[model samples]
Target: MANVIRRAEERDAASLQHLQAATPGMPEWTQVHWLGLLSGDAIVVIAETDGEVAGYAVASLLRIPGEVVAELEAIVVTPSHRRNGLGNGLLRYLLAEAQAAGAIRLMLEVRTGNGAARALYQGLGFQEEGLRRRYYRDPVEDAVLMSLQFPQEAVAVEKGQE
Candidate 1:
């Protein structure tokens, strides 16, 4: 099946939320929250498989005094789409988008038990920076903080310079 990945619009929140609901250890977000994200220019990406949402990646930028960074809030892929590169696509898309927005760093926290997600982030250059105890409340899980620096290449990309 063909897959198309792009910046998520307000209309996609519904489908994206549904896909997210299928995943465990994730907080359910409301449409109002999702809409606010798109309207504010926060990073939100989605993958469409045969025109249906298969996954999503949400991130936000933080500017504290003189420092600015991007944080990945969540990255989830439906069971039917796991192990098919959709998650990686969504992640890389988020990294590229955030980098273009002047982000010097990309960070995320994944449950230590989520080996697949950890492997994916590591494969994308995100190294474990720390650990948070009881980071997830749903089933009570620990989280490993991971991060990757945006190389000079991030500034040299010829596409989507805006």
Candidate 2:
């Protein structure tokens, strides 16, 4: 069956936690965190395949003076769903929403050892911006900060031609 990406709802809290657990490098967030994302400047979306939650992504929208920026908080795909484009679908949905919300940039940090995730992000036009020392626990590792900047839409009217 094809994967369907949709907005996350309150009912998805438990399933989101389950996905997090099934993902090895995912951050451990509590129910409170999931609840907080449901109704704020945050954007959350989940991918479902065969009536099961396959992956999810969370991001926050920040209006910075003249531009809006999005910070990706978490994105995890179930073990069985990895490498099947579920993560890519979830991120594409989130990026479209962010762009509609006026966000011109997206930022995220991934564990340095997570080659799969890093490759996915890189393939999607995200560039490595920086590195954080010893960012992960359990298995200590550094984090590679990545960001993608969207080009501002050009105005319909030309400067001199108008």
Candidate 3:
């Protein structure tokens, strides 16, 4: 499969939106919200495999006061695309893209039971920092907050001294 990861274009909204809805363990975001993000500063990325959309992820550069952070809003891979390093590629792309945009950190919240996602994030240097009570509905899943420091090059430098 020639899986290509690229920014989600407006032309992909309908297909991407359907994929988002079909994705298990993903939040239901309105079509309007998805379209707004595509039209705004948010980063909506899609992965195409064999000429078909395989997965998508959404991220945002958040600014507050003097602080800047990159928030990975959603990362969803069609079950068919799982276990193929597609998730890893999308995350690495987001991390590098966000860092280039001046993000000092990357943050996200995943369900406590999502070991796959947790492990993936941890492998990329993200750490568990906190939790949100009942952040997900339709079963009331708690959110486990995770974050990774930006500029991964700095992490390598610091590790080299250890």
Cα lDDT, model 3, residue 82: 96
lDDT of 2 at 125: 98
Model 3 Cα lDDT, one tens digit per residue, 11-103: 888888899888766667777877888899788888899989998888998987855688999898888889898899899888877766667
Superposed by TM-score, candidate 2 places the C-alpha of residue 32 at a distance from the truth, in angstroms, of: 3.3
Which residue pairs overlap in candidate 3's backbone? Answer: none
| Per-residue lDDT of model 2, residues 34-95, tens digit only | 88888678999999999999889999998889667899999878778888889899999998
Identify the superior model by lDDT, candidate 2 or candidate 3.
2
Question: Candidate 1 — which pairs collide?
Answer: none
- Among residues 3 or more apart in sequence or in different chains, the pairs in candidate 2 whose N, CA or C atoms overlap within 3 Å are none
Give the better candidate number (1 or 2) by TM-score.
1
Model 2 misplaced stretches (Cα beyond 4 Å): 154-162
Per-model TM values vs. the true structure: 0.90, 0.88, 0.87
Give the lDDT of residue 117 in candidate 3.
91
How does model 3 score by TM-score?
0.87
Pick the TM-score winner: 1
